[model samples]
Target: MTYLDKFPTATLLVIALTLGLAPFVPEPHIWEKIKMLLAGTLARPVDIFDLLFHGFPWILLALKLTRQATRPN
Candidate 1:
């Protein structure tokens, strides 16, 4: 098992808080893109990239936690 498998909850929390919640002075680029998405704006190349970049960690962490929960102890 990798380090992520060993510490899925901690890993998820850190990623979620850092990438999803923490505010920046100018605000995060991903946050702006996410707002655009919510407002029904067309996605630009950079917006797509920003979404994927910020979203990948959450996707990975959720998958890890789901796998861990369903696995037999």
Candidate 2:
């Protein structure tokens, strides 16, 4: 079967976006308290690599979906 027949594109996009975004969701904000306890030590860099890694796929998928949605089937 072809790609469209194999999966609903919107469902795939939601799943992909959810999985891609899973890492960056702050952990219930409880970690803020922990950080305070530790005096904000062990600071993690704003992982630019991770940002790009997670970001590009979603942007591409969005663009693809937009193009497909707007175009006549």
Candidate 3:
């Protein structure tokens, strides 16, 4: 929405780097969740929630890019 339009790109990037790819030890949280998703092991409720939680910032960043590309307003 217009709210996201007003959201700063740098802030989104920071969020994407931080929460989107958190727990950068063994592997990024999002990366692990994605692997679980592809391996059909993401059926647990908490795993599902983890995916959504970590993916939210990236999702918003993607949505922002898509909106900017399609709607110049």
Question: Judged by lDDT, which candidate is best?
Answer: 3
Total backbone collisions for each predicted model: 0, 0, 0
TM-score of 3: 0.93
lDDT of 1 by residue, 1-73 (tens): 4766777588687887687544554877567767889998836887687778777777777878788888899
Give the clash total for candidate 1.
Answer: 0
Indicate the TM-score of model 1. Answer: 0.63
Estimate, for each residue in 1-73, the C-alpha lDDT of model 2 and write its tens digit: 2454455677768855675565545642233434443675434444444444555556656766776777677
> In model 2, what are the clashing residue pairs, if there are any?
none
Model 1, residue 50: C-alpha shift (Å): 0.5
Which ranges of candidate 2 are over 4 A from the true structure? 1-11, 24-46
Best by TM-score: 3
Q: After superposition, how far is residue 42 of candidate 3 from its true place, in Å?
A: 0.5
- How far off is residue 44 in model 2, in Å? 9.8
Query: Could you tell me which 10 consecutive residues in candidate 3 have the lowest summed lDDT?
Result: 64-73
Residue 48 of candidate 1: its Cα lDDT? Answer: 81
